[model samples]
Target: MTVLYGIKNCDTIKKAKAWLDNAKIDYTFHDYRVEGIDADMVAEFFAQLDWQNVVNKRGTTFRALSDDTKASLSAETALPLLVEQPAMIKRPILVHQGQYHLGFKPDQYAKIFASA
Candidate 1:
């Protein structure tokens, strides 16, 4: 099964959901805000994607972080932070057939689905 992880209100998540619906792809939406994310889950993401790819540096949550926290970010440091504040994760992480894709783009989805 395909699972999409993100916050509900994010514009990118909204667009990703719409794209999935329009493509008629069957998927499960896992809202981090509502469903909550765990350390193990965050670790799984890190295993598939690099910390930079998974973390949303552009978001307000990240911007609000202390300079020390930002400068000291490593997988170990960021993992706990990501678990504590799931909104800092990049939106719409798609997991399908044990493969992971971070963020979204129509062409990218098309390619992924086609190759699948």
Candidate 2:
């Protein structure tokens, strides 16, 4: 099964969606913000992903956080904040056949699908 997780409005997500559509790969999209998130889902996201990669430190969401919140960020502390604010998570995490990938690139998508 192939699943894509990200906020719908993200430009990166749009690019990934377009790439998938053009590639004719069917996938399920999980918008963590609107659909909400649970511990299991969050845990699954972190299974192969590092907190630094999973968290979008460059985005406004993360930038707006209090210094104390930012200072103490870690694997243990990230989950609760991710549950409360999914935007803090990076865009377009593509999971294919149980393998997880973060962000989007045409070449990367092509390679991933080609391997199938």
Candidate 3:
């Protein structure tokens, strides 16, 4: 089964949800804002994904962070920060077949989940 994890109001998350609906692919939505995220899940994503790719450094959330918070971060420091600030994460993390996808694009979705 596919599980989508993100904030409900995020545009990318909305788009991904809509695309999944349009495609008639069944998925469970896990709103991080309401449900909350833990360090282990954050670290799990980090384990499989490059920090530069998975972290939304350009986002307002990251931009608003203190210089020390951003500067002092490495994998060890970043994981807990991600747990504290879910918005720091890139949206619409899709999980299926024991794999994780950090974000969504229509074409990429089409190619990746074509058989589903």
Instruction: Report clash pairs, candidate 3.
Output: none
Q: Against the true structure, whose TM-score is highest? A: 1
The candidate scoring highest on lDDT is 1
Per-candidate RMSD vs. true structure?
A: 0.9, 1.0, 1.1
Q: How well is each residue in 3-71 modelled by candidate 1, as lDDT tens digits?
A: 999999999999999988988999999999899999999999999998888999999999999999999
Taking all chains together, the TM-score of candidate 2 against the true structure is: 0.95
Residue-wise C-alpha lDDT for candidate 2, range 1-116, written one tens digit per residue:
99999999999999999999988999999888778888677777888787778889999989999999999998889988888889998888999998999999999999999977
Candidate 2 regions off by >4 Å?
none
The global Cα lDDT (0 to 1) of model 2 is: 0.89
Number of colliding residue pairs in model 1: 0
Off by over 4 Å in 3: none
Better of 1 and 3 by TM-score: 1
Model 3 lDDT, residue 86, Cα: 90
| Order by lDDT, highest first | 1, 2, 3
Q: Which regions in candidate 1 have their CA more than 4 angstroms from the true location?
A: none
